[model samples]
Target: MNWRRLWAVMLKEVRQLRRDRITLAMIIGIPVLQLVLFGYAINLNLRGLDAAIADQAGSAGSRALVMDMLATDVIVPVREARTPQELMALLKRGEISVGIAIPADFERRRIDGRAVAQVLVDGTDTVVQSAALQLAQVPLDTTPSANAGPLRDAGLSAAQRISVVSFYNPERRSAVNIVPGLIGIILTMTMVMFTSVAIVRERERGNMELLIATPLSRSELMVGKVLPYALIGLVQTTLVLLLGIWLFQVPIRGSLLDVYLASILLIVANLTMGLLISTKARSQFQSMQMTFFVFLPSILLSGFMFPFAGMPKIVQWLAELLPLTHFLRLIRGVMLRGAGLFELWPEVLALVVFTVAMMALAILRFRKRLD
Candidate 1:
């Protein structure tokens, strides 16, 4: 209600933030570094995947097919085996992702127009399995599918055309999905952790009483305190996204407007949560430890590393309560899926609710203590 008092408190908070250069650098520098590292290291499309071959026929046709696979850049032949049993043993030992078995009658069958080859692939890892399947389907010089009748005339049979699309991460690349989620994690962790320090430092310096003597209400005071941190969170998001685009070539598929709106909502809510924690915390160290506990689940339960579907029922239920989980889904849906508001309304709604709820709680806690 008091505009002048709110602006005065806002200016004070901004001045204090400006004085803290180390915290500023941490918020701005780290996100960019993470973006560059993750962008280069994470690949959904596997390349030069290690594999083995079992060539029972040792015929010229089979050898040429093997060479063709190697040339495709998907599979790199690591070892050769004389029998299927040896190839199987190697696969079980984790030595290879794909195993090509050329039948003993491969050349004879090709001459007789009855050629067939077996491709053994390790399906334990989804990304590697997808890559292996594609590598195996490479046709050898022996196929004359153009002349083959009806079922086989299409060059690929029903089974061969089986479409495998990696959802959430269609390219099956970790970085594409991961970098977006990391933005939310970094924003949540840094904003919450540091904003707690803002209030805790005031308490430590015995400045809370002095600041409370001013005309600012609890809501105005909290807004002023959190606004500078919110700006920092915005800067951090920008640095990370720019690095991802320039260094990693990560596409920004959705409109920048949607991403911008979602980010503001999420950041404000996280900073509010931080303010609430500071109200309860007696020391900076306690605030940090509590932030850590909150961050761990936010990272794990948010489906950052593992698939949500693969997690147990309880874990899945827990994930639903986390803001980071919804934010991650929204970020990925926007960045990778090019999803608009219509497609992302559920996630958008969750973020809006979370921001409002957390900010309200922080305000009530601050006001309750004041009385």
Candidate 2:
């Protein structure tokens, strides 16, 4: 390297970068997106968790107990339950994050200096369980019973006898929670990456003309490109499932069919998303970069690495748009909680819509003619 020649080459490369607007946009966009997700969206200090109120006490003191928990900002009362059975139903359906069951002897227990309420928490996410534990220690200032007013450590350990029960994950094993979500993250990464560059690789390898010459319709061609990888995705799913069971002891509580059904839906959806990116990308490198754009949110906001209930409402809304978010819920519900597809129908429905939308978009964006 001569100094003058090196300077000239550096400037030439800078000009080339300036002209490739997609690369330039990615350079700026990726960091900004990461900052927003990590700084604003990813929150571990969870609050406002969905809670069901089963006020069997139906007394002023019991109402005060509920009010005190609400004041802590640890949980949001989403529905009223007249009985503990109904609250259990909601938890089984994955409808609420926590359930508060106030017994008929709530006031009497408070008067006798006992844990007055039973708090049932969805323990799939540890952060939320920690929040529930924190909530259990909350002091009720307006209790009608003077005896209850002095106690703060309700049922768990000492005074505030808030019997906090962590359902579905009584042992609080990290592997139990992580193994199920890991499957979704793996499928998302591999399936999207496999097909994100499919069309672009075909174009780069000089096979675009052959594809164009074929009599296969665009829909047929798109589906064909994805079907093989979809099978690979299923195989990956099975491998992860087996390894998790053997090594981590993560059990599949629900029907194995439900797990595969949800995985298939997610696999197809992610593959189509990749195909969509491939249709838009001019080269394989660009396609891979775009795949990262889709992957980042899936990892951060899809309840894989952080608590979904902890994120702000707007960030939660954004997370809802990612297919990985729905799949995580579906898989975890089936495996950890023994929930069926009927119970997780909303997530199943969202995935179906996502798969259809991505497939349609990929087909429409695909062109037979090379520009």
Candidate 3:
């Protein structure tokens, strides 16, 4: 290689990169975004988990135990349930992460030195469950009856024990938690990247102008572009699901029909997002940058790689805006917890809203580009 010629080519490429402001910004911005997400938003220390209490004993010992659990600042009881069914219903709806049940004979058992309280944890999220288990154990080390003072003075043995039970992934296998979520992450990445480049490539090659010149309406053109990809998304979803089942031994606890239906909604949402990116991007490189901009948050904030509840409140609010976040919740709920439409309707509604909003934006942006 000629040193002079190589230096000249390198200088030319440097000038080209300097002029491409979007790429330049991405080079600086992507790292900063990653730092912010990883340093500030990503948290492994689980705290302030949503908890529900079913106190059947209604005694001083039971009240003292509840207070002790809350004082740990790990599990925050948000609701009270009258029965076990109500507590389980809360868990199924993803409303609470942990449930505490004090049996009717809890006081009697504690007096006999064999008190047992039940702690039911949602084990779909292994990280959260692990932290909850540790937090739940804190109360067991102390005697709730002794803390009550009255029970201790009554000559009762100050001892309390808790039985911890996990739902969904009873064994706390990471694969069972991760494989179902991988389905959504894979779909989001592929669908967004694929559709983001589609219209931009057409425009880059001078095909979009010809298509626009035809009698075909913009909506028709958009639909035509998206339909095939939507079908492809379905195929991809099926393949991932099968692979997860075969390789990871992940069980599908809910109806396969529910999973398919939810997958379609999620696929459409991501495709619309990609089309929107395509409309805004002037080149394939810009499209790819924008795709990564979206993709990073989808993986990070969507609870695909980290626990959603572990993030701060503002980050959790931001996570709610991501379609993948909602889809992860939906897919995980169906696959792990046997949750149905009734349990997952909120996430389903969020996906529907996301699809409509993205489609509208893409259509508007493309029309303006045409003008």
Model 3: per-residue Cα lDDT over 115-199, one tens digit each: 4577889999988778776644643423444443333333422222566788988888899988888888888998998899988
Clash number for each model: 2, 8, 0
Runs in model 2 with CA error above 4 Å?
140-160
Q: Candidate 1 or 2, higher lDDT? A: 2
**What is the lDDT for 296 in model 3?**
92
TM-score for each of the candidates: 0.58, 0.95, 0.91
lDDT (tens digit, per residue) of candidate 1 on 1-371: 99999999999988876776544555675576456424543345666766787888886667887787788787778887888787766554445656777778766555444434666665434455566667546764544445533333335432343222233344455567567877898998998898777677787888888887888888888889889888899899999899888877777878888777778877987888888888776678767766865786677667676544344456567778788888876776677656665566777788788878877887787642332
TM match of model 3 to true structure? 0.91
Model 1: residues >4 Å from true position, as ranges?
Answer: 1-161, 165-171, 367-371
lDDT, model 2, position 102? 85
Candidate 3, residue 87: how far the Cα is off, in Å = 0.8
- Which one wins on TM-score? 2
Q: How well does candidate 1 score on lDDT at residue 160?
A: 45
Name the candidate, 2 or 3, with the larger TM-score value: 2
**TM-score ranking from best candidate downward:** 2, 3, 1
User: Which structure is stronger by TM-score: 1 or 3?
Assistant: 3
